[model samples]
Target: MKRTPFGAWPCSIARAVDLLGDWWTPLVLREAVFGVRRFEEFQRHLGIGRNVLAQRLNRLVDEGLMDRVPYQDRPLRHEYVLTDKGRDFFPVLAAIIAWGDTWLSDDEGAPVVLRHRTCGHETRAVVACAECGDPLRIEDMEALAGPGLRTAGTAGTARTAGTAEGEPTAAAADSP
Candidate 1:
């Protein structure tokens, strides 16, 4: 069966998953953040097949997360570098690391520890509210209809005909 296209979803998380949901994609990004730039380095670090690694690298470049930069003159060698968007993915990786260390680590403890550069203290990633700067808990948040949510009859079904720009439509407001 054909899979649903997550890019078409109105949710931001769904769209992000559409782009970065694949297993190898995140691994590749992890290596990139750790300073693995050359094809051989990524292949060696990941132990992934050459064709799959090449495909993932190409996809990352095509998706604007990485840029291929020429490093050698004679053989036309290139290295992958993270773009601004790719750099922005570090927090996501940090959060994953924090979760893994907390729940998956052995009794000896986490394999790696992150230290803050300025204060020289260990740090862990946490999800916090942008406005209040308070750490967020899953149980404390509620999902609410946003303005970008697609309203009925606009593309799929017949319902309310008009919704003001930036206003949640009646159909969306009524949806659980």
Candidate 2:
């Protein structure tokens, strides 16, 4: 069956999910973030199928998140390195790790912990406002209508869920 492409969705969350929703992609990214630059190292650490790993690496390179740089000239071996775009994704992975550590960890506790290099202290991931440095919470946020919202025949206005006449708001999914 063909998967629905959420990349074209109007929502940023949907677009992000479309790109990073796959099981292996995030793990591959995690490996990269951990400084796995060579193909052999990634394969050895992940134990992923060669073809699948190749595909993920290629996609990441094509997306400008990684650069495929030739490291050896004799056999033309190339190593993957994260671009600025790829490095920026580390925060997202940290947030995921934090959530898993909180809600899904075993009794042994989190398999890993993040320690700040500068402060020399363990820290938990938290999404904060760029300008204010305050933690972002759902209750303290509002989703305003953006320029990308479809508004051809209607006046430009933000509509809360259940407030839009004749429009249906999505019901919560039973499982994540």
Model 2 TM-score is 0.85
In candidate 1, how many Å is residue 50 off?
Answer: 0.8
Per-residue C-alpha lDDT of model 2 across residues 1-176, encoded as one tens digit per residue: 98899986777798888888899888988999998999999999999999999999999999888999999999999999999999999999999999999999999999989999999999989999999999887645545677676543334454434344555323322224
Runs in model 1 lying further than 4 Å from the true structure: 1-3, 150-176
Give the alpha carbon lDDT tens digit for every residue of 5-105 in model 1: 79877778888898888899999999999899999999999999999999999989999999999999998999999999999999999999999998999
Alpha-carbon TM-score of each model against the true structure: 0.81, 0.85
Model 1 alpha-carbon miss at residue 149, Å: 1.5
Instruction: Evaluate model 2: give its lDDT.
Output: 0.84
Q: Who wins the lDDT comparison?
A: 1
What's the lDDT for all of these models? 0.87, 0.84
